[model samples]
Target: MVEADASAPCTDPDIGNVAQARRRTRGPSLDKTAQTRQQIAEAALAEFVEVGVARCTMDRIARRAQVAKGTLYLYYPSKDELLRGVVEHALRHSAVYTALQRKKGETVRAFLRRSLLPTMDAVENSERGLLARLVLSEASHAPELARLYKELAFDAWQTYVQDLLTLAVKEGELKTRSVSRSAQLLASPFWMALVHNSLLAPDAPQKLALKPLVELLIDNLFSRSAGDNANVKSQ
Candidate 1:
């Protein structure tokens, strides 16, 4: 005890405890950061839906998220950025945005029908529908929101459908003079149904049915042999 060795490892409990606390308080892990970002995006979406985007504010979104105002800004610097983030977050969970692989020997049309129909049928009643409605309702007033929605959602779907149509053409399942136009045609029914059911006739006695309309469009777009058409009709 006369003198402590200079090279000896530190045995101070206080020092060790302080080091451990520092490590713990260094920062949130990557997962925690992602979770927080998602929380903010969801909160923003809720605010935008409850109060139109034009009326929505960062303070409200931060309060809704239970995050500090600075925290919200850290994740999304501006309202337009937040809008983009919210749309991206929503699309991440949408089955329509999921990249599905066609089964071996499955035609592109069949693959699209099988993959998209169920999701499309339920989309009108989901958060996605609400987001679409928000975009449409605010488009005239909030041009930025409209631009983000068009760039992120509309163009994305158009590109995805165009790719499928291109594949169908290669597989001899479809013959179209313009895949781009065909893609637009294929996706038009969903928007029509969405508008009719939500904006035009939310309280209508008979809501538009999306599944049959999409199925009919698919059948019309894809070239099927007489037997295949008969088989589809029989089913």
Candidate 2:
């Protein structure tokens, strides 16, 4: 029989515990790396918002992040990748998606007030708003980054809102033949308003008031009968 390889991990029981201990010791280092990456993403978001994606260079982001330009490369290989990181960072921290959480027996109007209002507020009055506007403005020139933004941010919100509408239909809170269409209808006005404000004059009178529109959507679009049908379909 040949001798065991000297560099191989030990099969001894004590060695296994030691290996796990070493892994535990490395956790702090891993946390530091993640923190550094997040810092870079935040810096990149600031740069993108200030000067837009095309003009936002890796050097600017690296300087803002207080990291070496080389270190920035290690975290994000290109400006496009960095832009995607910016979107990811926003999604991870934004309250927009958190607004989707529904409580037991809450009316659809109550849910909209809790969820939709916060979303509109975030779009109106946060660094997140600037970042969103940057993405929209730059998307035409940078389709790849746009696609990534859609995949990471837009798709997530669309899926969640659609599911919320579907659940509402099942709960008899919404009257709709298609939850997909209903979700689109519910969100279109707010989205359009945000787009208008971001692209047009901020104080435009054409801005859609979220509260009244939400009330109209609920009053005209929901029905107790729809929920009953949904229950029957499930059975």
Which segments of model 1 are wrong by more than 4 Å? Answer: 1-25, 224-235
Writing each residue's lDDT as its tens digit, candidate 1 over 1-235 gives 2122223221322333323433767856778888988999989888888777767777778889999766677677667778888888887767887778777767677788988898789888776777888887888988988888888889989999898888767755567788999889877888999899989999999989999999998887775433443333221
Please give the distance, in angstroms, between residue 9's alpha carbon in candidate 1 and its true position after superposition: 52
What is the Cα-based TM-score of model 2? 0.72
**Candidate 2 Cα outliers beyond 4 Å, as residue runs:** 1-31, 99-101, 107-109, 203-212, 223-235
lDDT of 2 by residue, 115-167 (tens): 76666555666655666676777889768778887788777767877887777
Question: Each candidate: RMSD to true structure?
Answer: 13.4, 11.9
Which residue pairs in candidate 1 have backbone atoms (N, alpha carbon, C) closer than 3 angstroms, thus clashing? none
**Whose TM-score is greatest here?**
1
lDDT of 2: 0.66
